[model samples]
Target chain A: MATIQHPYLLFLGDAPDQLAAKTANGVKVWRPEWCIGQFRLPGCKADLGLPDVSIEEAAAQGAKTVILGVANRGGFIPESWIVELVKALGLGMDIASGLHTKITAIPSLKDAAERNGRKLFDVRHPSRDYPVASGKPRPGKRLLTVGTDVSVGKMFTTLAIEKEMRARGLNADFRATGQTGIFIAGEGASIDAVIADFISGCVETLAPANSEDHWDLIEGQGSLYNVSYSGVTLGLIHGAQADALVMCHEIGRPHMRGLPDYPVPEIPTAMDTILHMAKMVNEDVKFVGVSLNTSNVSADEAAAFKAKTAEQTGLPVVDPLKDGVAPIVDRLLAG
Target chain B: MATIQHPYLLFLGDAPDQLAAKTANGVKVWRPEWCIGQFRLPGCKADLGLPDVSIEEAAAQGAKTVILGVANRGGFIPESWIVELVKALGLGMDIASGLHTKITAIPSLKDAAERNGRKLFDVRHPSRDYPVASGKPRPGKRLLTVGTDVSVGKMFTTLAIEKEMRARGLNADFRATGQTGIFIAGEGASIDAVIADFISGCVETLAPANSEDHWDLIEGQGSLYNVSYSGVTLGLIHGAQADALVMCHEIGRPHMRGLPDYPVPEIPTAMDTILHMAKMVNEDVKFVGVSLNTSNVSADEAAAFKAKTAEQTGLPVVDPLKDGVAPIVDRLLAG
Candidate 1:
């Protein structure tokens, strides 16, 4: 993994809407101290509520990296964005991007970084090799947020838990495993880009041995029932050796993502399958709670659903955004 | 995948023993008509029992490619071997290798191949991009050989089944998913070498829609209980959309491969877990038979073990090498 330097100058390059700059919003919300200010191109529709800073002003303010925080269609780095990136590199700042198109692959950005002696970080692609996972139990504790399907708020749930743990002065760190999470963390591998043989190994490396008192809140991917991505999910489960797992689910998903014929697994079935696989590496693995994405439901519906789920599973349930992860964190601490 | 031209000259370059040239032995055993002759340098300790021919003689004998068929220490193509590879390229023959060190990375062989307008295939690396698996059922009858552990004869069992099915005038093709299997089949991707997200997708492409009666005997990889590689195994299961599955297990395994503390999963437990995961994609998936590697046991022990296993699982059980997979094929075709 690359040591992406901060304070970051987030670049919202002509984003079509606020949703296009969600990555920027995540960074601002999670690591506000590391953010210097936002830099926007002409016709940009997103704002980070920070003062607009130019390349020169950001450099003067000691920004060490210019982050490409907005996603456009196709995840491409537009030709116009390259000019701003090149200028940032020339002004003694590294560049970090989570786009499908690598900033380092642009010749102008590449040459400028080389001449200026700065780095270019493509957070989506791993920057180092990983060994085959040994599946040995390492020190410290881990809690993984697995899901019923993709895009079910696993990352958000994980980050919320990390925040709650920190508020209580618990020793915990959020371990990122995806592109946006990688950018937010400033340094972590995107596990999906790794070779199939090394998926678990990459996760093992991402959350290595630490103090026995500490917790690594590992962000999860895919799902045990998702035919398209269950491999990634299983690898993460094995490598995490998670002592506790938090199941994430959306209230109204019709089917597994991208596979219309496959229905989302029932919660109990999903829990049984995931726990069975996780126990191969950690025999003591247990489910601490459930996190729901109840955005589609009204407040009354969300509360009713959460209560019913809690009663059914005998575990605390909450919408991480609406209710926070306090109930889940309380269960984790109790254990 | 690379269309590796055959009529191959097998290069057994200074291998220490016959086991080192097992890949060459496999190709000769499975695709004898495609092998021209064996090529050995001085000090070679292994022989494929074919006529020893020089590059010029092999090319004259209609060899389209020179296959590096021995595993040396570190899987590196030795400096001495490159000279012969370049010579073969000049003689209108392409080069194919399954070494950890890629032949195309060697400047001399790469330059030679480019100048001669020939191809250099690194079979251990995927040659093309793959889409994520859709998990939709395609038109084909597929049989997948899953395993109890890594190196438990999944590939051999699959090949044996293909041979038996072909001999019976049944429509079947062996779908390779590893380096040795790739060379035997002439064209297929090494599934473990693929990007994590594309593991199932690569398998989907390798064994695509065919005539409804045709069978693609897709070779499997690591075990579902093997913590290090269950991800690859799960991905393969989902992508196979297999109508029939053959479980391959080695007799008398004390523990899971590479993990001292993890015991090998019992056959019934393994079957239940694998079938549960497989059902996520193909609800009708069934275990047609079990293939055992009985080489470690005496003849009496092998027979008793096979009979016991058959009774335990209610499926045909056979040592793919000794028993010839006839019973398993009968079971498969009967359905």
Candidate 2:
């Protein structure tokens, strides 16, 4: 994986709403010091609260990369956005994007980058070869966030824990595995984009041997019970070799994401299956906490669900956004 | 997946030993009627016991494809063999190979095939897009052969069961997922070569819905216990959604294949884990038999091991090559 340079100029190209600029919002919230300014096309309604700067102005302010941070419908690069990207490339700013579209595949963007000797990073597509996983344990303390289904706040949980651990003066870093997280971390592969044979190997590469005292809070994807994505989930679990796992769940998920016929496994069932698989790689693996996405429930219901889940699993339970992850951090540090 | 045409000319290009031709040997043993004749280059030591014919003669005899059946050191296509392959393509025959080297990537061979309007199949590489697995149970009976470790004869066991079921006038077809199995089955994607997110989806495509009584004997890959490849194994299991499963094992003399520190799971442990995961997609999933690769043991030891395994698991036990898989087929039919 290429190490994406930062001091980023975030491009919110014609985003119709703040939600479409969620990727940009994540980067700004997580790495404020690394961001220079926001660049929005005409009719763009989203703002990052940074000064709106033109490409030349942002380049003069020492921005090294232009990040395409908006996710519009269909995840395609509009023809209107090409000229500005070409301009950024000619101005010696490399480009990075978390979009499903590969900006590097566009001829104008590709030519500009090549001509100006700049790197183009399509973070959602892996551009390097990864060796098959060796399955040898490396020296690092790692915590992974696994979920019962997709979009269950695994990323939010890990990021929250990283923040809490850092604020407490502990040695910790968030290792991203998805597009939004990649922009926040500034370096990591999209695990799902890798070839099937190399999923575990890619994870091994993402979180390699670090200082034994350091905690690498690796982001997770998919779920063991999700038939559509369980393979990716299992690969992530095995490759993570996590010493600590935090099960993430949504309080009122109707079914496994996208498969109406499949229901999400109960918290205990999900934890048991995850622990059973994670133990294959790390015998010392244990669940330190449960993180709930309570967006679908009332505050009273959320509190009740948290209390009941804590009793059922004998672990710390918290909503990362609502209650903070300090309790999970306490448990992790205690261990 | 492209349906490779039949009446194949087996290309044994200077193989160093009989084992080097093992893939070719598998095709000959399983689908003898589909093979036209063997074509050997000078200094080749491996033979399939078929009449040796030149490319022209094989084409004249109605060969539609030339199959590369040798596993040379490092799996690279030798420059010396390209001319012959090009010649065969010019003679209006498609080419297929399981080598790590893709024949279609070679300019001379690729151009010849293009000029002649013939196809080139690199069976180990997937050439199309696959949707994420839906996880919805489709109609038709499916049996999946899972194993305790890699290279423990999952493919052979499935082939044997398919053969037995067909001989009894049962509706059964062998669905291949690996390179060698693709050659035997004539068409199927290499599951390991798919994008990580698509492993299960590829399997679903390989064995789509069939008649209610028909059986798709899907070949399995990797092992849920093998640390290096468990992700592939889990993906295969969930994608299979099999109604019946046959556990394949090799007794004695082993750690997990290629991982010295890991031991293969015992029969009961292996079956339990597989059954648990398979049930995520198929609630009625079951173990119908155990297929032992008893090549490591003497006849008496093999018999003792088979008897003990059958007693322990309460499933029919057989060596697909040695005991003819009759008992396992009997159990499958009875179910």
Candidate 3:
């Protein structure tokens, strides 16, 4: 790699929240900012205020480079985003799996990114679809799922949290298969059918996503689709599609009580909650990551929560801004 | 494994279209009739129509589940709709990811869903502040940001497209992260920021979803979220986001001969368009998976385009929906 220079790195993405944390030589830096975007399905009457962004815009911001972060959940951010990322960011965009949109966008984006001084990075280590090549699924292995809640910034903080652990060195990964909750269909699809469908759907996704030493980091944002910025995907209810199980709390309320007394919820503590969920998803939770939302909690509180989590979970907690993420990535990578 | 009755499986969501074939055995269905309620983002001028329900609803509805479907886009959808889903659909009610409305509603929702034999499926993933275990970053091996636009059904149909391949044994887990489109968010953070903020301020929304899977057979009457349907989410954008992506022919008068009808610019043959983008992104384009809008092109045309791609790149040209998503995921997972 021609000895890449410039220690400080900021991953600008349409999903700024997902790209939180400033990094330098494997250490954390200034407040990590995550990009949060809200969108609505065309022709639909609702507006889902979620966290996401285009790879192009992410790169366009002119950072050393930008990372295309995907939800560990089996889905995509539109082929257009990937295509844009290739021409915008360097170090490339990382795809969770080459299933739906990524399959189409990444490849196209690979070529685009190459020309733009960037490239596409595949994050799906052992795809479930490639059975012969994939190793068996093992809990507490390399990959894991760290569930999260609403609040784009929190999600970003959580998603970008690998730096701290990496700074120390650990074997872990988060399975971010977008929020997993109840899904519904107007038709008469039964619950068992729904559960089975949910299971199978997720299996189909994470199965191909199967990998060794890999863990999951799922998010259970309150109130899935149809509701404001809270709810699960429609796919969850139809097929058995939850491989990265997540547990979240509803924070998308207005003037809610017990909060830090701000528009945003208390993030640091919220992260502590997800750490517990990480254990439930995988008992031996090797390492932990958190997603903080400044809008919700104070930076100090977020930092304090980090220490508390380390004390409670007995697992190293990472804050992308304070700790570089490369070290954490190394720990998660197979030797 | 104790012959696990339900397996309590988890799906890595992806495309709903391709999942139709994949979900036959284990289905993941979304209410094709649902809609998000978004007027405009707190900063941006776009909308996001997300889903609203819980994991409990999926279990009850009997959706086998597949990859990320649309509906989850959080932009607009009356908050009351969520109440209806919780009250009527039971497991059908879910929450979007952005904003604070739903996150704050969790405590009360537990009662509503539990009383109806459903679970809220909370959101609690790791944050950027997650403490490190083994003193390492433990960055997950991958990241995915999945979503869609054009409404819930289109998002569902477009996102679920991995099915045709899954039936062939491709594991394309879908995860719906709602929607995040360019045309949706303007370049300026001022307006965009406001829209984004307003979106964050939102929560506890309602979007009644309806899926378009093979079993559900939602053919003629499309979703209430589609342009065909009388949805305001699309109107909110004033044809900016979607229109920007559109290509047209310089035919005549105030509007020329439109496009879709005469097929002048012809939406640029998939191969030609991809190749153009490929050159812009990278030069060494090899494998590619094309999911053509069958609704727009004919079998012969699609075949011809695929043939052209193969001839031009000398790499594998796979049809995402038909070929399944396994090969693509396999390549990304290569050691």
Candidate 4:
């Protein structure tokens, strides 16, 4: 992950609220000063309070890359946005998009970027050379944080565990597999964005060969119980080939995110599902600990739920943000 | 699924004995003469008793479509096979490949096919327009047979259920997803071949709006517990929007297919996982029955295992072939 040449412009599409909450691609704003300003659709609310500028203004402000930072349902980039995207490309701005719709695949936008001698980075476009999972045990200690459902803090858990491990002077690195994780880590493939067949291969390349003493904190994606996104979840699990996993869950997500009818599986059931999934590729895989996301709950409620989860799972449980992922990191180190 | 115009030539690249097992793609031999024998590498035994012929010779024998029938690990087509494939295409024979490596994507192969006016039917190529799962309850009663792992009789169970249902005057069709199922039914896409994100969409296209009384028996691929292939499983589960599920397992199997290190999950746990996974998309989804593959066990063992599974799962159990899937079909029909 080389330093992305700076002076970026964030494209906030039709919905500015999504980016305001740090959902989807909003995490890129963590380094806000580098962003010249945001470009939103005409009449679209700029709820995030960033200066809304036109494509010409953004370019004048030294925006070198236009980052499409608001994700819509199905990841379909609006057709109207292509006109603005072309304008940005014509203005000598490279396009960086994590959407399922590849900007490079759009003929008009592609021609504009090519004429401008600018590049298009379709982050979801997978590498062609990812090798299939060999099922043989690989060297190095790896730990993946699987969640009960999406937005259950899998990335946070992995980062927290990696942070704790680094604090102890152990060799560990957080492997990002989504937009936010990639933005945070500066280098990582979006696992869910990789083509289904090559997801494991993409994952394999994310954390290349490491020494047996090195611990790669591979981030997990969608839950096994998430029917819509479980394919990515399974691919990540098999691809990571982790020696052990830390299960992550929000304290009271009764149903899948945005899918109220789909009830979240109990912590034990979720653990069993993930373990069963992991054991398919790595027989030695075990549950190292649990990371509970108690953001919506009180501190006392979080602690009570954490204790209950630990007792049920017979694993150390911690809220990665509140109490730190020390218990899980310690377990991994001890093991 | 349209009629495949095929006077077929089976391509068994490296290992000939694998196709002899009548597993995976070997069941394409269900229609023997459509196959103008098999084409194998020199010195590789064609143990299935099909005459070994060269691609040129097979083309002369009126083979219209060359079916890459034997699945290799990772579906990697040998580079040398491409030379033979191009020669086959040069002779005006359409190539029907189920491999993960798309023949149509190969530049040489594509050019040859285009020049020769021969079509490349990559059965695994998913339709680009698969809609994301809306999570709405769809009309009609659909049943998907989920297996403990790959090769655990999901297709066999599905076909048997369809047979029983049809025999009982119910309108049930076996929706095929694998090469064998396609060969048997004369139509179906290999769901595993589809890009991971579009698996559900492919499944949706496989069985469109059916009458309320109709039952579509979707042939399942891979297991929810099999980490390497669970993406396809979850995709099929959600895409089918099944009302009831039939759990399938092989008796006395100790490990995941191909992966020797990973042990097979117990039937109850496997059932729990499938049910939990299905419930995430279709809240009304239920396990109507369990179908065990008792090919390895004696009749007595099979019967005892069926009885034990019934007791363990509290569902009707049967070996779809030997015992007939009538018990399970009856349960589904009853429901």
Candidate 5:
């Protein structure tokens, strides 16, 4: 099997008018790059898990894809994000996600995933996980879930997937995590306290599946990689012991707004975000795929962008919508 | 003061590109009736709030001028923002806010308060009463403070103000809000949540002075009213709540790069931001100014942008570094 690109993309935004047109003579113009920019998700406080925490710690914990979710005011989510993910995954890839949303429907998401033979383990919600050393009985595969609860958008997406899977004569179990968080930006004693509480809280509701590995990792977020606000690089690499990676991006217009004053936004175009996440998580890896968020944008736009985006990033755009998401798992198996 | 004709203007950036050139295009011009579609800002989510909850809430509560706080990564705080605010205040005009940030030191922040015949309040990181009803035995005048730990550029900008003010002989106390927040959506439950916490937890620590009633407003933030995300109306009637208002903006070459798809590689322009904030904040009371964030862009390009941005917005170009931030604040105060 050929290699698959890592999945995971972070979409950022400046705004609509800013995204739509710029004044050449005090008039506006529609920019083509707006598509790529929209996919570059900024770090969200709600999703403050990225950019605020350490990448190494997250990668260490078997967390490869770190979601940079897009939470904008207007109802705007693009299909390009999932398309970007699928193309990056190569022909067949299996992966989890850095991005989760109840905004998009689940049936649609599943169809999108299956179209490509890719498998998306739709643990769309975030739940708490107990440390294996707690000496308590553990939950199984459920321990690797990302969110404590599927967001309003993610929850909707999961339910739709279940209904559609059943209608299509497919067997599936849609899962949701029941953990909540009180975010604390600290390390050493403080982080331990926060992490212990966070994990314990998750366990109270959902037992860490016996699948919870013996060893785990903690990741940092934000530009201050060593500081709090961890982005989940180490947990995926160290804990998941990833053979490859993929970052999920919403893939839309806002991702391209560059803040000159801030240096972090300077490095990655939406395309670069996918490559960088893969690099940050694994010291050695050749390619990766991305999950394009295709909730609001048109399919033509998504496909056109997928091709352009993939070509630019040197990774083929994987249509998570067309290809089943599990193929990414195959990459893990191949690795 | 005779009311200024076309007292209001709107700045819009549909996308980013050679903005200076766009504003400079030689063609039949059409002036916008209320809002503008030109100019942009040099700031991002870092400046407003990120990672921290209180700061995000503060942005929603304190925006006395317009939703400048809500522009997020789209634009800079237009120099006109301060300019108009100062002019209006000194001249005794009505005002309000759409975002969450400090005032007074900027001048327009003092809502009709006078100290020895001059505006008593300076743009100190002043705390205002957040309208949150807590479950505690309440003292009407008890102090409530909300801290904003901003991002790299923002923390630096905040620190710069401290340094500049102190260097120039101002005695001020600035406490770190610990960390900043990245994404604040609207002035709804999310924003209210953090501010409510501040009202509950920080009352004891604030130790309000008996004479604190001298001040009457909070600051500006993003979630309260941004064009896309939060939907704070950009129209003057629906914008800021200041007696008068001033907006500050950075004008540059990244013109059509207003929207997301295009990443002009130039730092996000600040033109559309200033105008948008200005329009949202007020139409009549004050003059607008420009603080081109020329720090990163080439001097040739930056210098080349001045006339175009000013002419486009119909606001005076004020250099924030040279003219001082006070004049703009004074505009918002009806002295």
Candidate 6:
């Protein structure tokens, strides 16, 4: 995957304030040069501290592309955002959105992009039909970071693992499965947005079959314990047919995000379930390690969390950001 | 679900001889009038004695419906079945198929059925758009038999449970999710055949809102441990919003039915995974009992297996067919 060389404007359209992290994540990771003034629903807190500028203002600042950075439920771009989008297109910025509801599906947006002779990137639409999983062994070694819950650092862990692997002189690539990863990498399918039946097939297409010395670090989605999206997770697991797995977890979460009644599952139980499920399709699948997310904890707390999780699961555990993913990378290489 | 009063001819259609059990299952359970001759692939055994006849002969025997009864890999109906299908339609018989490839998709077969004014029953097509799962409390209680692997008596156990419940004077209905159960019950969506995204939605529609005393005994599908089909299993669990569960395990099965390397997961782990996953969606879900499939085991072995499984899981275990589902029914009622 190559980086996008064109300067782009990040657009967070009428998103609820609670989604600031998601919006900020795109900016921080993708490092878009200029961001349009924040757009938010009423009562949303806008505290990210980026310079507030309108779409025209950002375009004047040399933004050649507009990337929708905030997530909306059902991925529907708001009606209000269309006007600003048109103005941006009129200002000569190409539009790229990862929403399930494609920007191309909106006639006005489609026409504006076409009239301007600019590309409209819809990352969710799969380019072609993918073959159903044959349960055959692929040529390359694949590593997937599955999580105990959504937003528990699967993507971050995957990226970190890939970085460490490459540093150690291994051929490694990060296979993106979500919007943030796609924005940073400049190519990938939003597996969740793909039609459910074809998700596994799409994942299969994402990670090209390669030789054994090559490593594909695949990002994951919803947990097996997450009912609303377990299908996506299962599909990714079976589709990638990974040789090794890294379980991801966040510290101090009492329940699944947005699911108050459902407590976060025990890490060991989650790990075992993933290992058994993966091995069911790929007989040689193994649980190589764990990746801990200690974003909100102190250094001492993070260390204790890592040690405890490692002891409990009997797998090396590390915070990718704090401790680096070298231990997990070593485990993957050994396997 | 109501009974199909029409006399249907079971079409085994060039399937290998080992699939006789699948054909015989439909006949024994659905009990269509006067058995028709078996069809076989060349060099295949035809030891299941029934009237050996062609499709035309079956139509002559007053068969008004042609039910494609044998299971095929990849759910593709063999090309050789087209000729017999054309002949059957010419005889004014309606065609019904449970295979993933809809019979209606075959232009010739569809034209024949339509021209003859006969209905084409594509049993796997979802009857209607089912609503996304709201995770709200459903009206009636539901009992779903989950399994450690596919073909482990989920449907039979569900039927047995409903039977025992009804005999004890409780309101009960069997919710079928596969072909054989659908044939017996006269109405059901094949949950496995539905597109992955809407599987949970279809299951939600199968067992509708009802009064408090009502009980919907939902038949299960592929196991959560079965990698090839875990999405279907997970979707069904969440969609059913079941209040109680029966863990089903087959005695003497060393591995998953089709995937050889995928060993049948240990019953306790499978039970816990199902419980945890279900509880994540439906907080009230409970593991009520165990259903053991002892068809291939000796009487003594079956008894010992039942006892050991019951002791291991700390739940009452019974062979629903031989010993009756009374114990499981009692637990469901108590819950």
Tell me, by DockQ, which candidate is best.
1
TM-score of each: 0.98, 0.98, 0.25, 0.73, 0.25, 0.69
For model 3, residues A1-335, the per-residue Cα lDDT tens digits are 01111211222223333222121101221222332232212232222233333444433443343322223233555544444444444434332222223432445655555555543323222122211111122333332322232333323333453334434564433333331111000001111111111222342243234454444333222212112221122222111122322222222345322222223334444344333323322334344333222234566776776676556544444544446344334443422
Candidate 3, DockQ score (0 to 1): 0.02
lDDT of 5 by residue, A111-137 (tens): 656786665532233322333212222
Docking class for model 5 is incorrect
Model 6: per-residue lDDT, tens digit, A132-179? 544556698888889998999998888878768877888998888887
Q: What DockQ does each listed candidate score? A: 0.85, 0.78, 0.02, 0.36, 0.01, 0.22
Instruction: For model 4, name the residue pairs that clash.
Output: none
Indicate the worst ten consecutive residues by lDDT in candidate 3 chain A.
A180-189
lDDT of 2: 0.90
lDDT of 6 by residue, B177-211 (tens): 88778766667877765655466667778888999
Higher-DockQ candidate among 3 and 6?
6
Residues A130-209 of candidate 2 have per-residue lDDT tens digits of 88888888998999999999889999899999989999899999999999899889889888888888888888888999
Compare candidates 2 and 5 on DockQ and give the better one: 2
Expressed as tens digits, the lDDT of each residue in B100-217 for candidate 3 is: 1343255555576567554332121111121101111111121111111121132233233334334556333232212221111100111111111122111101101123221110
Model 2 clash pairs? none
Question: Residue B102: error of model 2 in Å?
Answer: 1.6
> What ordering of candidates by lDDT runs from best to worst?
2, 1, 4, 6, 5, 3
Cα misplacement distance, residue A132 of candidate 3 (Å):
17
Docking class of 4: acceptable
Where does candidate 4 chain A have its weakest 10-residue lDDT segment? A20-29
Model 4, global lDDT: 0.75
- Residue-by-residue lDDT tens digits, candidate 1, B55-86: 99998999998888679777677788888888
Report fnat in order of the candidates.
Answer: 0.75, 0.65, 0.02, 0.40, 0.00, 0.23
Which of the predicted structures, 5 or 6, would earn the higher DockQ when compared with the native?
Answer: 6
lDDT of 4 by residue, B236-313 (tens): 887888888888888888788766777788889887777776776677889999988888989889888888888998
Q: In model 5, which runs have C-alpha deviations exceeding 4 angstroms?
A: A1-245, A249-268, A271-287, A293-300, A314-316, B1-167, B170-173, B178-335
